[model samples]
Target: MRSAGKPRYASVMTDPADFSQSPPQEAAPLDEFSLIRRYFHHRQGDTVVLGPGDDGALLVPPAGQQLVMTQDTSLVDRHFPADMAPADVGYRCLAVNLSDLAAMGANPLWFLLSLTLPEVDEDWLAEFSRGMFELADQAGISLVGGDITRGPLAVSIQATGSVPPGLALRRDGARVGDQICLGGVTGAGLLGLEQWQAGQRHGPAIGHFRRPRPQWELGMALRGQASACIDISDGVLADLSHILQASGGLGACLDEAALPEDPPVLAGCSADKQRALQLQGGDDYLLLFTLPAAQPVPRGCYCLGQVDAQPGIRLRQRNGAVGALTVAGWQHF
Candidate 1:
């Protein structure tokens, strides 16, 4: 499934393996408001009562529903390569924030972009807005308002969406007996990143890295089904631990062999390194949640493990021996 030029998968991974073959290039150097008006000012729908040109934009939340909001930021090199395509950067900036809304089982409505550019490059801004709006339109999201400043290249997006009152998925609602599920394959994005770092620009892994499709539809479907939910921004072990800790000391057990493995992206890697990336690699914006055993598993989702009574993550090896994790995933001190 492709929404606005980005792939949406029904299985472990979505396929649309195309990307830039060249290394990230330097940005070419623009007026800020002129750029915004030229590219960012797209039309809006009913949800956005007032669009992007005022003191503050007015939004009309659907009646009988509560608003769910989330924000995420990406910095040059820290989050993505400094010279990566501005279009990919723009798409990722909004997509990641939208993933947060998806984890909460919300239908994304509007978003605000706060961008810091070292220097305003018209070409970069055009491509960036193109990618951003492509995903936004596909998801029915509107760019309500935002700010642009001169600084290091960084993007922070604050997205707002709607979910029925009392029905929003939460990280703290998981129970002891619920099953742990993954929205898509992890580590592919990391694989993409590694390839980019190695100066290899185009491949399956880089495609996944550059353009990640958020599981918004699946999230909406999980509304009453998922006991607890979170997006995989910081990798499985770390993000899953957040659910466990939030759910009041509930632990989880993962079957090592049960995890999804994709050959094209992970081929040639040692088994140990493969497992480590799957367990600990960050930047894979997939969803992780808990569901009851009786509920039917949604298509495009994998059952990785189950919530347990104990308090920390444990991995059950193929030989049936369980071991504890000293380091689960990425940490941002």
Candidate 2:
């Protein structure tokens, strides 16, 4: 199920609509407020009692539920290529943050944007708004309020969601004997980046990197079934290590042969490199979680291993030998 080509949000109406913008043209530079009024303001969801245009947006929580909030900040040349399309920049920033809500098993509600641009480019702003709103609409999340100012190119989003008071998924509840699992394969995100850097315009890797989907529905399905949950923002080994450490320094053993096959784009790569890519590549955005041994794992999830009382990760090779596995993954610093 590789999604290839421009993301669904790529084709948007040029006419005024959700977060409408007049056709781009030469105009006087926009002041901060003018910028907000044109590109950042849009119809908010029901959760926003009063949105954008006030001291602060007033929001109401759902009855019998608690709020789940998360934020992610991305920068040009660091999080994305310096010359990436404004539309893709908008979609990628927000979509990645929504994955956090999914990990918490929360229902999408509203979000706030804090954008910094080096210049007020009307053409860029129009495309950016359309891209952001397209994903926002699909996720059932609305933009309530935010800030915009002059600075380097940057995108920050604070996504808010609701979950039944006691049922939010977390990373600390996993234990020995729980089966470790993943919603999908890895390496695609990094492969897409390689494709982009290589100047290929369209392919599975390009689509995966530019517009990766959050595993929201699967997360919701795992609310009661999963013992512990997290999304793969860092590589799986790194993110899974968090679950292990949080759950009291547990360990796990993975079956090498049981790992999902490499994405078709990686077929030309060597076997060892393929394994490393699946384990260490970042940005796949798949949910990595654990379930009780006796419980049936959800469909579409690959059961990679079983949590153990041991202190570190181990890999069970196809021939039956088990060896210590070093847990290395994406480093924030």
Error of 2 at 231 (Å): 0.6
Error of 2 at 16 (Å): 30
Model 1 Cα displacement at 78 (Å)? Answer: 1.2
lDDT of 1 by residue, 51-168 (tens): 6666678888889999998888888888878878888988888889888999999999989887777654678889999999989988989998887765677788899999998889
Query: Lowest summed lDDT over 10 consecutive residues: which window, candidate 2?
Result: 1-10
Candidate of highest TM-score: 2
Structural similarity to truth (TM-score) of each candidate: 0.89, 0.89
166-193 per-residue lDDT for model 2 (tens digits): 7899999998999999988787787777
Task: Provide the lDDT at 273 for model 2.
Answer: 79
In model 1, the number of clashes is 0
